[model samples]
Target: MSASFIEAMTAAAAQRPNALLTVASDVRPCTTRLAEVVAAGQRMGTRMIAAGILPGDIIGCMLANWREWLVVAVAAAHAGAVMLPIVTIYGAKELGFILRQSGAKWLFTPDSFRNIDYSAVVAGCGELSGLERHIVTGPAFEALESEGAISQPVDVNPEDLALLVFTSGTTADPKGVMHSAQGLLAELETMRLMRGGSDDDAVISPWPPGHVAGALSMYRYLCQGSPLVLMDQWDAALAARLVEQYRVTSSSGTPFHLSGMLAAAEANGHDLSSLRQYLVGAAPVPASLIEACQRRGLAVYHCYGSSEHPTVTSGVVDDPLDKQLHTEGRAIIGSEMRFVDDDGNDVPAGEEGEICTRGPELFMGYLDPVLNEAAFLPGGWYRSGDIGRLDAEGFLLITDRKKDIIIRGGENISSKEVEAVLLGLDAVADAAVVATPDERMGEIVRACIVLSSGASLSLDDIRDHFSAAGIAKQKTPERLSIIDELPRNASGKVLKHALRNCS
Candidate 1:
């Protein structure tokens, strides 16, 4: 048998059957012990095979960060099925696109969450050509468990595809990034070395399960037999309470989450001293945020990565505050990173250029062949499309992004996607979306528009249009600016840098 995550998790459970696998919250709190988690996965894996989900078939999961999500993910691995995690916040448009693109054989979702009827969303998605079964959590899943389980196990290999992560790019549609079991395991090992926490530790993860960061957190903790406390919805006060109650030793999030937790802890007088490492990334880290977290006895470190390759670089927990605040730290083990010019030649250490990386932790490739060809160089290094430089000591400093995308609260929002939506409105002649500085979210979407003659559109009007178009709420522009004409260069391209400066 190959080095499957399911096999490793089963071994861990055998050694520490009483360890807590997850502390999940829904209407009430629930805990899943390691042994129970393993058994649940086994049962679910049998159900998956009985439902005709074969090895290497795609299984989609569109649920929150609950215990069922973890169980289903591991079950997919045990059944030798490819796991595809869909963001819960995705609307019908995004969800339908993913379901159709991935050709998922089965989908797992909740009946309802946060007052949104997910079943209705699925029903409204028109046609899911390849979806053979839809399983709801709660009572529906229990009914499946009531059926007899299979006695045999599925065979899997380390090089077999295991995960498909859809990440928003410069286009309106998301790109499906693939990963093998071996690659993901290599990444987990690197993360373990970079951010140390043992089985005795507990992790408080607020990131959505759809993102690579959240999935990595779940798998990494399971591999180490650590306990995970998940938050279905992000509330700083609730997170602070959970940290204190569970004595969470490690956590990860963007600057916004870290800042909110600090504010909540200060306001409510919650003790957060149990936190040893808080890996902060997904957006530019502010010096003030790191300083505040460190003062509150939280070890905040800047980390860098993407959907294609998670955890490329990160600061050590014991590193100086200056290094943690200024740079993204050295590359983690098993990762080879470099900065190159347009010709793919290596740039000087201190010069800014495109960041490229390749290693065991790198993802397999994009789902689209054309995208894969464009994303890699001749030497198999994945082009990051980010502008950065390495210091003399190999610490990376990200200067800018080659793609015009705004990251708000760790979610990648394509400026062009929003711009396309705005241009579809009759009241808009031309539109360009840019990132606006914000103290909390790192950056928010701002639209600079040239309205049609005698047409007046407010920010509310634009937002309503986006909502009507079924765009995710996070992609909507938070601010709008009306201008006679966009500043442009000789090539007729709007100067987005100038628009950013207007903020």
Candidate 2:
């Protein structure tokens, strides 16, 4: 798409070396310019090669959304090595599994983060035969950046493996998803076009860099010359402040983040006029949230995608209010979408089916090729495992995940459909629907809810709300648990598997 990640970075640095890149932390925001970040990456890449990293070698990083994480990503790409960004939430058990599974030869992490002793975690990973070095950030890492730049960055093909991101593994162990330089950049360009980024645009990425979205934010800074504001920890008040302070134009997160930021802004009387578009996905978006954003004069829209396919469909700011609110928009340029039944046959138009996509932005395959067999349908289409239907205008309405359908007394209930109804209620702040075991009904809808502040709701109240919505009686949540918050992975998707085990 742009030659490669490093090529894009190098070109952008030459064009906009003074562009700002800020990292917001608890203490203060650390800001740097494009030239400095590129120089740091080049130095680190040289040091990596001096330490024996080769093309295609996997370098794993288990860090938060720190500035150094971006530098290391650039370093990895510059050296033609694959970057494996492990989420900081992962412990030694999960970390060990990923390192061993990915066969990563190098790892970069801090000694500790947020009171978690990552050095101890690395020590506890036991003996990893393939691991050559585990470099902790500090003097050791700073020394690497002090090295002289490489005479020449390694040349890599556009299709060479450049990124290895693991799924959130809400159900099973995480799978190592591989992405080539071309695929990652293609997705980046699609997003850049979707957001209508410009040199004047400033983006605040609240996601952890270990996630694909975060990685792309860093690349967007290096490649597109868009100023980036990164947050290590998610604080709604802080995010609201940063958005106003920096005049951020575009950002993306789940409904949880968007709602929280809006609340924080309202509480502090902060005017978030700088924000132009807030791209939302990775969870079921509530229509009320969209309505709330609209009331505040914010452009919020739904986007549908996952790790395997970063972005399949995304709504735009100019779409009709109904389309923007109700559907994840049509396929972006260069992407194709199809619908298929469980039998792997094409479903008729307007019929719900598993969403299949194939395009330049699609991932090559999982690192564990065995997992790829079931991941893709015949004819190179990647099975997204999500169920949705296309409208006459090509807008996609995602009903539920294939696994998310709750069968209650032989009737299929879309969890999102029920959750949408629940969210329409005044008291319900956030909700997640899961299938709970039942003695006679096979499985019933169980809703875990987070209520609004100073608001209250009972099972009967929820039932009444659903009754008012004119939805099927069976779709009403048979079981309800009002909790503080729904469990979420880094990308803000609900951990439905964890909820299934909850009593």
Candidate 3:
């Protein structure tokens, strides 16, 4: 067995080719193969560490989901180098910001993905002077893998940084998320309890490996020796087909992504009975989608957490439908969570406030000191920056992000709550509610909507649609912008911050 249990599975794969994670169409190791990946990482670690790159010096990687990527990642952790994962959608400027901020000395990027030249993106990054190595996926990444990497290992403790994850939260600038091996391992154990993993299980997912969810699946599935069926991109029809073809036991994606899958399955008549649980999160689930999933015998679990505090709140798969309809279920095992007021005092049950957490699952701390001190309570519980209320049963009902709440006439209106109302409207296909800058009433709730295709819906029609549904007049959208499409990130997340400039 390899040093890490996750690697033990990969080593097992070396002898048995049954374990797999491959992107469909043009199947080649972005690193050629796992053996090469392990070799390259070992070589780089020895060559780089001897040259003074510390165990935690961030090594950035941007690639599509490929099996060897995990091998290199495990190799980095074992070699004591911090893994710096960046989004694949980034241009040169954003890539440079991450590389520079993380103090990265090495970068692993694909030559091209869907024909976007990643080399061109990094070419524009500030300076290549600090970068000692630039390995491209196609041929270059494989070249390094062919020559055996240094076998020497470094001494690393559990508290050492294993990953440097970057995220912007609901509405903010991107911040570095440094996670120690111990904390991540704890979260993995929690996930195991939640997932009930097994070697016979077939898992399906489409989240890119650069993000937390994607990376977590890579290691988590490996620990139990499960085969991961991956989609290079989130195409609903293709996903449903893969589930049926792979005989997948579980599937996951963002709420919208899963909704798309359900829609495509309903439209194209794909058999998705293999999926026992439809894991989803990163946004609110509409009532229609919930019903649609429930009809398929696939239970939908809502996840409310972030990169800094991952998998904190999860709705159990067997939760009561009514409880699942209102709240995101209870906290996962091994975490302590509460709703706190503006003054950091814990609020009574059912009172809306920031969701604060204290547990071993949290990241080490944010990279910025000023930000770090402001982000957590003195007792070490990290403030989630999301406003929510815990029911008497300890189920968390999130109202809105603290910054996304609209204060109209001194009443805080959750845009997410209002969006749920808008989604219930028959004419509306999708909606996003935001607090627009207002000269009066502090801020007004405004909605941007995309109507159901072929449905000629007007602004007043939607307002009346909400009003007739018993939605409070004040809670109804004051102003509506009808757009053909909503601004979304690559992961199917509606970027409200991008919508802020729509007006």
Candidate 4:
């Protein structure tokens, strides 16, 4: 636990040189050895240091799920630089904010991923004062891989900032969350304790490498030397194929992802008996979906966590059916949770209040100093901004969310940010964004718009406007309703509850 990620990876690779780490993608599917990944990271890290990257420099990466992405992540840790992973879906608006806020010095991206042109996106950002170089992911990037590993080891502390991931919180702008090497390793250990696994287990991760869960999945292979199969993007049919082909044992995702995989397995008649445990979170989980997985001989359990604190509570496979179906499970080992009222007083045993937790896996703090005070309470407990209560048997059940955000297919979208974008449209006089229930995605953005006088708009028009604004498409409102005005209370604040009720 005292060693940094690179140190742990080096030790693990020395012990298991031939361990497998496979990446299954549309472009290429290659199974790499543990030694090969470590050597590549070392070579890349040596090149990075020679290129003038300091120990604490921020390196931004906006690549899709590829083996090269993992190599860059490892290389950042090797060179003692903090890795800031930008979601590939982010456009100029979000990307520019992150680069400017984090002050990233070096950026690594692909020439093109899917339909997005990295060169164009970078150019769209205009100017970045802190960015020293931009390296595209092709022969030029491959050339950065020096011929040999560095002879001297980099001195990295366990408590040093290793990762800076931007999360869409309840605010209009993204919050930069910092994590140390020790914190990430603690998260992996907590996960291991939560789920009992075997040495023969192989994991198929459909998560994008930018998200916190995806970042942790990649770290699992580096720290534990486990065989991991990475998917560049989420494709239910392809996920089923990878699971059957690789005999994958466990995975984690939202209920939406689980439903798709289950449907794909049923339609294709794929043998998915190897997949035993699926950790479902990041959105509301339905009891019916859990029952369906049970009928299919797959063990699906609910988990509770956020970017601030990863894996606070998790359900075990051996838990009773009633508990697994009804609750999000109890706090894992070394974690403490409690419910607090608005006044910060402890709620009664069976009452619902905001869920607060503190553990070794908690993030260090937000990059902006002003946000940290409101994010955490005294005694180092993080306010989850969620309403949940513990049952008599110590299981946590989430009742509602206090934060105004919509989670669509495991991605958190700030409703305020969406509303701000909607208000920028000339056709929109006023806007209020709320979450409407969705059968598949759990929740989606619904916009209640007050159009300007003598102006009109449609869903297609809103989508095109969002595209032109350089915002992520997922934040665009899926369902729209033009109204005379948004209902307001005495204080002139929009009554979001009324909008949700009507939606």
- On TM-score, the candidate that comes out on top is 4
Q: Write the per-residue lDDT of candidate 1 for residues 111-163, one digit (tens) a residue.
A: 88877688888887889989998898888776655445644668788887899
Off by more than 4 A, model 1: 21-28, 146-150
Range of the 10 consecutive residues with the lowest summed lDDT in candidate 3: 1-10
lDDT score, candidate 4: 0.88
What ranking of all candidate models by lDDT puts the best one first? 4, 1, 2, 3
- Per residue, candidate 2 scores C-alpha lDDT tens digits across 1-503 of 34977898889899999899888886335889998888898899988888889999999988787778878888998888999998776666558878999999989998787777777777777779999988888888888888574647889998989999986333335578899988888888877777775777898887777778777777778877788888888888989999999999889986767888899999998879989889987666678889888987788898887778888899999888899899999899899999998888999999999989999989999888888888888889998888999999999998876656665533345676677778888898999989887644557889899999999888899878765554436667889888888999999999888888887
For each candidate in turn, the TM-score is 0.97, 0.81, 0.76, 0.98
TM-score, cand. 4 vs. native: 0.98
Q: What tens-digit string does per-residue lDDT give for candidate 3 at 1-503?
A: 11343244345446534455545546442313334444455665555566566776778878667755665576566557888877776656457767777788778877877766777778767676668777887666555545544655676776767888876443324578888767877887787678774656778877777778887777655544457777666678988787887788886666657777777888888888978887667655667667777877888877776788877888877888877667787889888887788999988778898989877779899776667887899889999888988888888888877656565533335676677767877778988988776543446778888988777666687677765553445666777788889999899988988787787
Deviation of model 2 at 198, angstroms: 2.1
Give every collision pair in model 2.
none
- In Å, residue 448's CA in model 4 sits off its true spot by 0.7
Question: Under the 3 Å rule for N, CA and C atoms, how many clashes does model 3 have?
Answer: 4
* lDDT (10s digit) by residue, model 4, range 417-451: 99999988899999999999999888889999999
Task: For model 1, state the Cα shift of residue 411 in Å.
Answer: 0.6
Q: What is the Å distance of residue 36 in model 3 from its true position?
A: 8.4
Worst 10 residues of 1 by lDDT: 21-30
Between prediction 2 and prediction 4, the one with superior TM-score is: 4
For all candidates in order, the CA lDDT equals: 0.84, 0.82, 0.71, 0.88
